[model samples]
Target: MSDRSPAQHSDMLLFLTDEQLRQGIEAMFFAYQGFTADPDRILAGMAYGRAHHRAVHFINRAPGTTVNNLLGILGVTKQSLNRVLRTLIEDGLVESKVGRVDKRERHLFLTEAGAELERKLSDAQRARMRAAYRDAGPEAVTGFRAVLEAMMDPNMRRKSSALKESST
Candidate 1:
């Protein structure tokens, strides 16, 4: 149990006013912008955007993931994802293969060049996250992650949790 008294807990909850909520929302917006700044700069030179970065990041996280599974994870339309996939494939950043057990399914993996680009993008983001985590301390980082998970939609939360589980 927490050490705080009932009155103290109640008072803390009451402190979350409209203005406080707005400030929190604004903070999240700015934080997201900062989080993507480095990657955005790198992608801009290559004529890509956040969508491309997200696809590469996820494909790297789960190598040999199917296109259908990726569509679910990304929550994007098939046409939109197809466009990105086409570009990545044409650039030799990603390779697509037919599933042995399910010939109809297409499994995606990063090519050597794709892995290098993924490393560059992730390194930038990781450095920012590492610094932020260090500055926030362990407890704040934990709380921040909890807040983010709570903010996700139920389907997205499940997908994210599955990815986390798979990585471990």
Candidate 2:
């Protein structure tokens, strides 16, 4: 019997066939669809796309977050995000105001209606996540989280970890 760390075990199993990789790719595609299914339905009735949903969600999560901060979080180009933000603001869902200390910076917040919509969208996703987590069980849930955290880019992991720490 050989004793190897979990990382070493994963490294040793790195040789995968084309079929295996194809299966993984298919699984990821399906998983993404499943993840988006509920939100897609909700957005369909509202005439808003995933970009609006994402902006509302992050604004709800961190009210008064700066535009630059959101641009960083979403990893989207400034022009792209500006279009979404403009639409959301015009639709009365998001409120963007010049920063008190720094007039050039825009801080974002969700209105009452915006918060309601955000809650509805989040509830749908949470229901899906809850069911998947329950089906996967306690051990798999832990390992799944670990693997996802490990998969994150170094800077992203730092930001994610910081958010987790702050929320707790």
> What is the C-alpha local distance difference test score of each model?
0.89, 0.85
TM-score of candidate 1 against the unseen true structure: 0.88
The digit string of per-residue lDDT tens for model 1 on 36-109 reads 99999999999678999999999999888888888888999999999999999999999999888788888889
lDDT (Cα, 0-100) at 117 in candidate 1: 94
Top lDDT prediction, candidate number: 1
What C-alpha lDDT, on a 0 to 100 scale, does residue 84 get in candidate 1? 97
Query: Candidate 1: misplaced stretches above 4 Å?
Result: 1-15, 164-168
TM-score of each: 0.88, 0.84
lDDT of 1: 0.89
